[model samples]
Target: MISKIYTIIKGTGKYIPHLRVKNEDFLNNTFYDTYGKKGEKSNQEITEKFEEITTITERRHVSKDLVTSDIAFFAAEDAIISSKIDKEKLDYIIVAHNFGDVKHDNRKSDLVPSLAARVKHKLKIQNPNCIAYDLPFGCPGWLQATIQADYYIKSGDAKQILVIGADVLSRISDPHDRDSMLYADGAGAVILEGKESDTPIGILAHTTRSDTYQFSEMLYMDTSFNPDSEHKDALFLKMNGRKLYQYALTTVPQAIQACLEKSKTPLSEIKKVLIHQANGKMDDAILKRLYALYDIKELPKDIMPMTISWLGNSSVATVPTLLDLILKDELKPHKINAGDSIVFASVGAGMNINAMVYKM
Candidate 1:
């Protein structure tokens, strides 16, 4: 049986510090300068390459003193405020992140309880039922948390739920790798309020699939802490870009189709497609293929492809940050009506693909 509809009461976002690092800045400060000095390339050539490979023009980064939880706190506070639902009414807080406090062995799940306790205390909520927990699922974590909250609200277990996605990519990337150029840091959130209605503005249908066989495509571990190794940079994100791209191309479209089928919605009914924004070229290619498969002329103008070029990719925060940008007018004007559909799809490091269809 299908669950009843739930409304998104509010949404809030907090980006990492607004330090603008331009392409030229990278060329001048990094090893790329050596190539220029040898007369093999010019500054303009380096800048063009940076722009071509990354969608981020600028991205946020946490200061050395800050951590992932700090960013999560900021985003959660904004979501609580925007919901206009008193913090006292918040019964649950679920945070989604790929990385968290370094010292915590349990990561988000165990780390959030104390933080939630402090927040509840500061808000002066008399109820002791408020609970907090963490979920770590890479880039698709936010969507997963949203669906979980929706179920909680539908089950009449909570009134207001706060879902936050936060990550500090700068600290997780391999400093010497060229791929590290594609990472950044940021946080975003949404507040869900339970409601029963035929009107569909929140989540409609969601589907998730994972190929564990491809798990090695992306992996991270604390190798730096190994007693046998003297290298302090042992812990970092490792990804095979070529393999990841191939997986995304093969799996994401199928996921979207499955979501639409489950929702009983047709491709023609969709007004906009909000993908993971992982890469500009990949997104363009996917949309083109979709257009051909559906034989549709003139794709919707509301598609948003904004990503932090200099900041790299913030994984789970990407979708929410893009949504935040949309709400803030980064997405162009369009005709999104009550019955129109919007498809959100993500292909992340776990070799996982998630797609959801929403009626706007």
Candidate 2:
């Protein structure tokens, strides 16, 4: 039999902006006044109810002077340091994001200099042989990049790859949109290294699907159109909360199950699942459905660790950042030990849903 090559998570790192935004910050907000329930209740009361539903008390946003690439650089640096690999040895750098560097004034995506190339420049990788690219797979972008890296390793085409997921939704968000409160800014990265191992450690199997024909506009922004068009209101992120929630509940669980089946790993063997921190309630519901698929009635408390309560939704950065925190023991009461089986799942724009089964 041919020698099996596996991609292992060598290290992880994250960059969270220093700025913290509390729910109360939006008190008397124009967004809530117009679209939210501020008309019927006080802002404070509305904030409380908002917190109750999403469990989001606060989130982070980059400073006015920072851009998406700047934050991504910090995260990439940390991942490189933790991996202890020479900078020149990095064979690939994949960045997953929606909007590139957003001009704070205009709120436009600046993608001329691809975000991956910017990250490579920031990392000071002088080797022209090192290839860098971007993957815009919605919130599941990071996981998707990891899956791709796994393929490269298995194909013997790459040795070490840095996959970074980041986004500055705060820049693209409309202050008048209630969804603004649901978005944040952050970056997370991981170093995937190829290693020869007999045991099945690394990405074992994955599944992904996109239903954009029907739900293409379910969670998207209004940009990427002709500037001269009459769609002047196409600048901010728009989402159908209920429809997206229903989509996640229906699709995410099935994707995870399919991945598990492909991996031939039992649900009971999964130690923890690093799911996208989209919405606290919706994520919980997705996990409940996942457990139900295996006929497990009661959901495991710590099986699904979440940081969205404080981190909000940082688009693609949620999973990797949460994974980094948990791996570092910074997120207490949740830990991943050696030989543990883990699942990573996410659902987002493109109406895309994906999941991967990994062995540690």
Candidate 3:
């Protein structure tokens, strides 16, 4: 008889950078519009507009001395400690990040040594048997990694795995671009262990898709922001907020529904919907649409937990960090219990959308 191996989220951890950047901090800086000319909008006007649209009051940025891998190690160590799992026992370490230790000011990235390998080294895992790699799937990267971990566990190929999502998008953000207000730096991680279970108690189902045809160009970074400079150092992140908003409203709800269908779990049984913290309003729209698909008129107030107001958008790190905070009871309005159905969803840069259904 084939024994069923379940991938259980044994513990969670997160690290938010020490530098807290509030909206008012941008008031003194001059910004440029899409054109090369200085922006006509005043600093107050820009900050107010950004806050009104995204509902982001502040975000955390990594200090100049630290990098993405540093924060990832911190979060990973915490996860290992909380999980009570031995460092030498880790079977695999998967890291989700867009830029590997890129400087916030330079937009340069180092891919020579994989970020996951660096994390493993920093944690001082003497186990040469531990496999490590990096995954770059935009903002949905972390959830996607979890789905992969589930596969490894069910296949009995691994006993324990460390999944981490860390990003320093702030370094690639263009201060002149309004989207800069929405970017931040942080890392979140979870330790998943394979355990024998008769009943289904872990990741149930998942779906990941890309809409590169219509939305790939909606969010991107390039050096073309400065028409006057051909130098490679001018790269910065930018986004078509309107296009992303519409894309999330139309596609994210359907993605969640599809994921739920695969899990064979009823909508009413879901205790919480942890979504990527890209924009507060966009997330609410996604939630409402999800409810509409279920033919439920009223959206539950606490069903979808949000941290964008404080954390901003850390790209792939948002959902995991939010999940960690909720698990630790840092977020009062949200909680997860055994026998609960939880849905995780995210949409971001690649114009990618993914969802996973997990039963606890």
Using lDDT as the measure, the top candidate is: 3
Ten-residue region with minimum lDDT total, candidate 2? 222-231
How do the residues 13-37 of candidate 3 rate in per-residue lDDT, one tens digit apiece? 9998889999999887657667767
Which wins on TM-score, candidate 1 or candidate 2? Answer: 2
Query: Distance from true position, residue 31, model 3, in Å?
Result: 1.9
TM-scores of all predicted structures = 0.82, 0.94, 0.96
RMSD of 3: 1.8
Model 1, C-alpha of 204: deviation from truth (Å): 1.1
Clashing pairs in 2: none
Compose the digit string of candidate 2's lDDT tens values, residues 8-70.
999999999999999989985654332333355666777788788788999999999988888
How should the candidates be ordered by lDDT, best one leading? 3, 2, 1
Ranking under TM-score, best-scoring first? 3, 2, 1
Q: What are the per-residue Cα lDDT tens digits for candidate 1 across 24-44?
A: 555552321212223345646
**Per-residue error at 53 for model 3, in Å?**
0.9
Question: Ten consecutive residues with minimal summed lDDT in candidate 1?
Answer: 29-38
> How far out, in Å, is residue 111 in model 2?
0.6
Count steric clashes of candidate 2: 0
What is residue 306's positional error in candidate 3, in angstroms? 0.8
**Whole-model lDDT values for every prediction:** 0.67, 0.87, 0.88
Give me the runs in candidate 1 sitting further than 4 Å from their true place: 1-9, 28-47, 102-126, 199-201, 219-233, 309-311, 330-340
